[model samples]
Target: MGGEWFEVLRPPYLPVEIRWERAVADGLPADVSHAFGIFDTTLCGVQEAGMSPSDHWWLPERESACDACREAAGVIDDRRPRAMRGEDARVSVARRL
Candidate 1:
């Protein structure tokens, strides 16, 4: 596992009372139906069992996201610049050619 984190909403339909969870990005089920039966433990110790297939996975704004999960997962601010390396450090595609 690369220790990547993902924001997940177990019950997708809820708008006002929605609380996003930070889950491990590795080994996520490819089939939505398969995900429903499995138990998922969030970073903040929330366990989700027999969840719905409608569960949504996305990056929500920090304000609406789970504070405990985010802190536990050590999520970095997206607005901050990440260090570039290897192929990603290339100045331009034309230079490579």
Candidate 2:
């Protein structure tokens, strides 16, 4: 809340959105599910509920967002092509001497 609302620009996303000075200034939920649910809503609510004042939403200051931030907020990586099941996309091996 100490930072300027305008200073923090909305991330580029398909559905343009804006965020306030979001700060996780409290103890977090003991599990992931609850945390995820809290963030499933808006930044304001999240902040009020002790989450970050800055959070992701479908609309930023009532404007549609660019595709990039939108997808990322929704945990979607569009730039990366779809992968097949059991695809060996990487190779890594470590041996200790």
Candidate 3:
């Protein structure tokens, strides 16, 4: 959970989600090699040169939170479990009852 996702502030205080690996590989500082790291694109494919990483979480309720990034990260408000989808939904419900 900790390394799965990270957030960064884009222009106008837009908070976007980024994958941990991509961030580290692309320029997120993890050690000496990434000391001068700088991330460019977000999970939602928004590219902005020289984006810095933030230690904050992606609060979806925030006014500046990026919706596209939220959707790309599968951070939606859907209450249904991942297993409860399509034909499996009926089967799951029957088992629960």
Model 3 bad stretches (over 4 Å): 1-39, 75-97
Q: How well is each residue in 1-97 modelled by candidate 3, as lDDT tens digits?
A: 1111233222221122332223223443333111112356665565545664455454444455555655655543244455443432332122332
- TM-score ranking from best candidate downward: 3, 1, 2
Look at candidate 1 and give me any clashing residue pairs: none
Candidate 2 vs candidate 3: the lDDT winner is 3
Q: Write the per-residue lDDT of candidate 2 for residues 10-90, one digit (tens) a residue.
A: 223332223222233445332211112245333223323545433533342333333333444445334433441123333
In terms of lDDT, which candidate is stronger, 1 or 2? 1
Q: Could you give candidate 1's per-residue lDDT for residues 1-97 as a string of tens digits?
A: 2222432212222221233433433354432111121256554455555333345542344454555545543443332234432223322323332
TM-score computed on alpha carbons, candidate 3: 0.35
Cα deviation of 3, candidate 1, in Å: 22
Worst 10 residues of 3 by lDDT: 1-10
Clashes of each: 0, 20, 1
Question: Whole-model lDDT for model 3 versus the true structure?
Answer: 0.39
> Which sequence of candidate numbers ranks them by lDDT, best first?
3, 1, 2
Residue 33, model 1: lDDT of 15
* TM-scores for every predicted model: 0.30, 0.18, 0.35
